[model samples]
Target: MNSLTHSSTSVVRKASRFLLTSRRFCDTSRINGDEETLKITWETSEMDCGFAEEHEKISVRRTFLESTKLSASQVLDTLKQDCPGFNTKLALDELNVPISGLLVREVLLGILRRLSFDNKTRCAKLAYKFFVWCGGQESFRHTANCYHLLMKIFAECGEYKAMCRLVDEMIKDGYPTTARTFNLLICTCGEAGLAREVVEQFIKSKTFNYRPFKHSYNAILHSLLGVKHYKLIEWVYEQMLEDGFSPDLLSYNVVMFASFRLGKTDKLYRLLDEMVKDGFSPDLHTYNILLHHLATGNKPLAALNLLNHMREVGVEPSVIHFTTLIDGLSRAGKLEACKYFMDEMVKAGCTPDVVCYTVVITGYISGGELEKAEEMFREMTVKGQLPNVFTYNSMIRGFCMAGKFKEARLLLKEMESRGCNPNFVVYSTLVNNLRNAGKLLEAHEVVKDMVEKGHYVHLISKFKKYTRS
Candidate 1:
């Protein structure tokens, strides 16, 4: 029979049993005997279980799953006392219910409690397992907690993309999330391939009553620059302005760098003017980015102008800023200007690091000035900055280019003795230099060595097309 028919039958049987049970305790008394029989029957018929109440009880049990009485602290303490470096999965299985709520605070505090490991990444992995349990249960509240915790773990561990996914899930679940949550989501999106989702989701969330925070706007702005979405970046800037939030230095930097990438150096300068007009004091990074554009771009004059402007504005140039300027001048074939930056770099009380020496050494090598390059290399060693592969490679290439093959071969041997294996460029240089010196057999031997050492060696290849016959 169908369920409804079976249920009706059961109800009839229950009503009959209630009538049979009540008849023993009741009597058809002297007065109104027929009416009393009717009244007793009606009372017995009315004695029924309320189906709505039973259904509601069943629903409450099914939906909430008997929420655990265990606090997170209690769970953690029990796990620590029992497992003590053992995975919590084994311990969780032994528990009747799971922990949930305020995931960020719990996870951050939990990790801090287990700060014994040197690496500390294992703690995050454990956190991952805990959250996976929460997700599997499909408990929105608990799942939200897990997502929140995962965001923190991903943020601290620099797994930006994973954090973004968690935020997306939280949004989809219709949780009343915070601006900080969305900001982190945007940042994580910035680092990953699916960065555009951050912006789209943020805009969509406006219907849910969230206005863009500074971090939200900044995240989208920064991410746009990452993917070179120039058009959208401008659109976002306009949107931010309309939202009543002024774009800050960070926004300007992204726009400037994006302009630089698009070969719009003039536009980048114009943007810089906008930045100044907005009363945003250009920070060190702003100057650094501009210096990078000037130094790396085909505009040494613009770079020099920026350097002068920086000095006038009292923004002291660090070793890195000077390095970029020096390297840029060298790349532009302005050796004297390069040396001038180096001198000023030292005079400004920023001591040159190995990077500075390497730049100048590379410049000399590119100019085919072997003697000056070697002099700089030796000077770096004398100043107690140990020579790295870059230092050795620069000197070796300089020797090879100057047609000093004998010195190049000796340097190669010295490199090997010092545990520095010659890379592709070094091998190619040796082979080509030997071939040009009329030592074809030696060239072949070097090619064989490169193959055995797993270095790429195309005998007919050119390191520079100018070197080939």
Candidate 2:
């Protein structure tokens, strides 16, 4: 065998040994601690998904409150009406209302939500003034949610310094800094394209005395992965090892993902070997990472072999495992192979979900196989898998790519008929493709529809720029 094959074989053997021996090294105390940390990790991840949803729900729930003597909406309106421009503090100081001790958590949150809706820094300042005013009240103390909300505003408005100050204040005030807070700071900063700053904050956590969780390094690394900061993740992993923190299964999976993302294949294998030697076994996430790397690296056979090995180790391959492989294959332009694996997924008793179908459809579309894309789209529907906004967007984009404007429009109508309302992407795809095809009138219609449907009304001005004489 070639050196690469030999090396791979050796890693596989070590992995096998690692998997078989991992149970023997399970320390009860450590396992309990790790489980609790893992629970926090899972909650943080769940919160990330539900963050926007929960925000919307909160806003909606308080939209029409019962007419109390002084309602939240009335207070918010008073603030907006009186606090014109940036003179929020001045306006609040002059207001002859007993605002202190009257505002509950819900009221405070509602007011903050209203202020944050515009997502302007000026608005954040107004929100912060109100927040400070409330804090100064003898009868009122900000809840953890209140601090998180205000911090979110600051982070969203790029007021990192203000956000950090708030974090320091939270710690100083002896509020329990939970995993949610840690995730919020990292994710919001990362989303704002300040991933490096997240890493910097994590590195400076000791300096700031900002250790939220016992597994702070792992939490930071995991949060960084969510934001796709592969290089930062690897750097943090290095820092973790330097700080004498042993790599857990999650840490290994995270660093392995980083290595895969960075294209450090050799280093990835070496890390696997090291993990095995360290008595860590490959979990489902580990297998998924390896599957993604192997398949996307155009080594489908090796990926399949790995899948077999996974089964041999009594690890059931989930739909996610199959989807990861299919996605990687699709990325590698192996559409046929993707289909083969899709079949294999079903044969292995895992039914393909909309995401799985979407990946394959997207693959066919990207490869310019529009007919195959259409076939798969139909097949998914026949299999009772309704195309989501993403699937519809993919098909619509495919249709537009082939200059089939009529078909794309029909698909848009079909999306609405099927209760899949076209989102910003679907509308933008149509407008852009129609405009590019010189169907200016059609593009204008799509934009008008988009505005009427309450999506990107501001895009009208931008669209006009391109359409102008």
Candidate 3:
């Protein structure tokens, strides 16, 4: 209980000091001006509260030396006061505490633990400076654990540059990067979609005896998918196989995307074939890929066929999947077909979402079926789907296209009053609709309003012509 009490008090005291030193704190390297208070609700365990256990796995030597959380501001102040110019060689040497002392090292490591918001990034710089200083101190060579720990601090805080520096230092020091470090680094890169670095870290991992072959590869492939690095994605897949790693479902799906992205239709199909041949079924995402491509290609019939194929193959269609097909049919100007398809989707137990309604409504509008579109728009509101700006835009554009200038103008007002902030399309549609209807003065007023609202005129000469008219 005494030790626990002491430890908690020390952390609070460090944080308290920073709050008092407001002047010296300025012009200092802080994260942002966001303040965070660290709270420790849990105190000592029953063992500490009552009698000492005859046997406890706890070693006081290790326990006491283990670095604990201290406020970041406190760490910064301590370093500036005690280890002034921490990055400086002279300052590190002139410190009262020995440069290589455990106390100093503890403080350096302490900056990293349970760091609050605004503390993470600044604390990282301090830790790295300590790491740099460790190299120069003959008595203070950093262990691999130290190397890994420093990298973790940087990695979690999204301090990639600092993380890379520490990794380079680890390699330079002849320290064999552990599987632990490699996996963490690779995972960090992949999670962040650090596309370029994924391959780099994997290549570096090859130098280590322990290569994390599963999650590491998955992480890289997933990240590569994010950045749309098709070439690198293919290369990584190929190299992963060359390294005697089996591709998982995640791996195949990743390669499928790469193939699709690179316009390799044949290759894409081959990948899909290989995925099944390898005994791994494509997840909903994989099926969505096929649906997406068909929809995007404007082949609504083909898209419907894929949907039917998905159902026959036991892939339950979500509202999202149905929405994609609906959008494809809508874009094709097949209002009847899209409506029938939406009904089929509803019958198939997929309730229409707002997107589905919008897509179908857009189709109706596109086909000069304004009344049906208006009814659906109202239905969407009645059902709490809450028509968004795009929905309003479509209706406005539809009215304008149909030469219903009065309705379009009223809709514009409604959109503004509803706090929707009609975008470029809405304003442009209204102005052009007015002009086309020969209401030149009304169109000119809209143009003036648009200008006042800071809307950019993409076609200045067009505006001049309108003004002249």
Tell me how far candidate 3 lies from the true structure as C-alpha RMSD in angstroms. Answer: 21.1
Q: Which number leads on lDDT?
A: 2
Candidate 3 structure, TM-score to reference: 0.49
- Per-candidate TM vs. native? 0.49, 0.80, 0.49
Clashing pairs in 1: none
- How well does candidate 3 score on lDDT at residue 413? 81
Which structure among the candidates has the greatest TM-score?
Answer: 2
Each model's lDDT comes to 0.66, 0.78, 0.68
Point out the higher-scoring one by lDDT: 1 or 3.
Answer: 3
Locate the minimum summed-lDDT window of 10 residues in model 3: 34-43
Model 2 C-alpha RMSD to native: 13.4
Regions more than 4 Å wrong, model 1: 1-167, 170-213, 223-239, 242-244, 293-309, 387-469
What TM-score, to 2 decimals, does candidate 2 have? 0.80
> Per-prediction count of colliding residue pairs?
0, 0, 0
Alpha-carbon lDDT of model 3: 0.68
